[model samples]
Target: MTMPHKTIPESNHAKPVNLRIREDVRVLIDRAAKIRGKTRSDFMIDAAYRAAEDTLLDQTLVKVDAESYQQFLDILDRPPSGAGFERLMNAPKPWQG
Candidate 1:
């Protein structure tokens, strides 16, 4: 006798993902999750999903005409110097200290 098998809908199916992280890192993640009012798994998944999206988006290349390309190069060669740039350059270096 063959027993009937039940299938779950694709959307309702989830696979287990295991990770090994340091205790300190886990504590940090837990604190952030608590502040956000979400479980650690949800917070980690959201962060990982966003990072994957950003990685893909960063790899996108746009086709440009030669004249526009030269303009971009010019801008890069001589970035505008303003108060914002000065402030950023003069900011305290906590890491160095």
Candidate 2:
């Protein structure tokens, strides 16, 4: 059986960014890029983008135990307080002012 091939979507390349690195770091990056059959810029961009994504995701992701997870779900299931509806109904319209 032949395994299906996944395609990478085309990326937008309208913006450019410049970076400065030491010679030693540049040499190591070049070596790794060669081994991966990718250009130095492509390798650096992909690695940097992945690292940025991982950093942001690490910050935003939540981990909870089973009991805490159930409590969280229970909170979401609760009905909203009527105060919100009252505030909306009493608020002045911007267009009227």
**C-alpha TM-score for every candidate:** 0.65, 0.53
Residue 33, candidate 2: C-alpha displacement in angstroms: 0.4
lDDT, candidate 2, 6-76, per-residue tens: 32345685578889999999999999999978889888877877788779988996788999999999989
State the lDDT of candidate 1 residue by residue for 3-92, as single tens digits: 863322345567889999999999999999999787898888778877887899999999999999999999999966999999999999
lDDT of candidate model 1 versus the reference: 0.85
Question: Judged by lDDT, which candidate is best?
Answer: 1
**Hey, what RMSD does candidate 1 come out at?**
11.7
lDDT of each: 0.85, 0.83
* Residue pairs whose backbone atoms clash in candidate 1: none
